[model samples]
Target: MSVIFTRRSVRSYLPKPVEDDKIERILRAGFQAPSAHNKQPWEFLLVSDREDLKAIAGMSPWAGMVEKAPLAIACCADTERSKFDDSEGAWWVQDLSAATENILLQIEEEGLGGVWLGWYPDMERVKIFSARFALPSHIVPVSMIALGYPAHPHRPADRYDASRVHYGRWGVSWEESRSGA
Candidate 1:
């Protein structure tokens, strides 16, 4: 819970490199994520090369931070291992989402910071990643996470809202129950 509340999407990073052990722990957390039918249809590609990072940063407008990050992990989906056929119908996206979240939480635990850069639904970006990384046809790039020592301080946000909570029925507000109405 502490990790969940403290996790922040850190964009700016220091030049210091991340420890190999921390990276391993983050990947381990990602692998532990739940998947549909226990298919575990995910493959992680770790990028530490300066040239490769710069090239990948060019893949998306929102991923410019990848150039500065000490490490970048390409979160990919293995369609061959997944149960669904086409990329559109595959449950791999949900599985990968859970994995990504777990990775972020673990990053927070490691005292590092990172941001999730989306790519999967965008075919052009996916094609670029595949071509650049020489990913096999069975693997589809889903997201890229840029990680490093944070240049900024951690600030957690509390997003809970009672108004959004419903008791049982669709419109039965939690407020009504609390007020004994």
Candidate 2:
């Protein structure tokens, strides 16, 4: 829980390579995430070469410092298994979202830092990453997670607000229920 709470968006990283064992642990955690209908359509592509990372960074300037990170994993989704009522549908995005969250949390737990670079939300990134990797038509590039040892520590944030929690219905905050209201 401390890892989940302290997890922050780390945009920069130290020049240290992440150990394969730690990466395995993180990927294992991701694979453990629940998927709708047990249709696990996620595939991870690990990229560790500095030149490859540089190419990725060049494709997306927002990921400039990500080139310095020693490891990155491209989250790809297989559209074949995901169906909306027995037809080719787009339900894979939600399933992939759950998986992505698991990966992010796992990275934090593994004492590594990472940032989820959006690829699905933006068409530009989709084209860029897909063309770079030569992704198949059925596979969608969801995002790239830049991972490495943290160059700086993340300060804990108090973003949770008690007032934001509503019980049962709109605006009847959870705080009201604890007092038997």
Predictions in order: lDDT = 0.93, 0.84
Per-residue lDDT tens digits for candidate 2, residues 105-126, read 9999988889888778678878
Clashing pairs in 2: none
Top model number, TM-score: 1
Query: What TM-score, to 2 decimals, does candidate 2 have?
Result: 0.91
Weakest lDDT window of 10 consecutive positions for candidate 1: 81-90
Where model 2 places Cα greater than 4 Å from the true spot, the runs are: 84-89
**Candidate 1 local distance difference test against the native:** 0.93
Listed in order, each prediction's TM-score against the native is: 0.95, 0.91
Off by over 4 Å in 1: 84-88
> Going through the candidates in order, what is the number of backbone clashes in each?
0, 0
> Per-residue lDDT tens digits of candidate 1, residues 1-181?
7999999899999999999899999999999999988889999999999999999899999999999889999999999888744345679999999999999999999999999999999999999999999999889988889999999998899999988899988879989898998
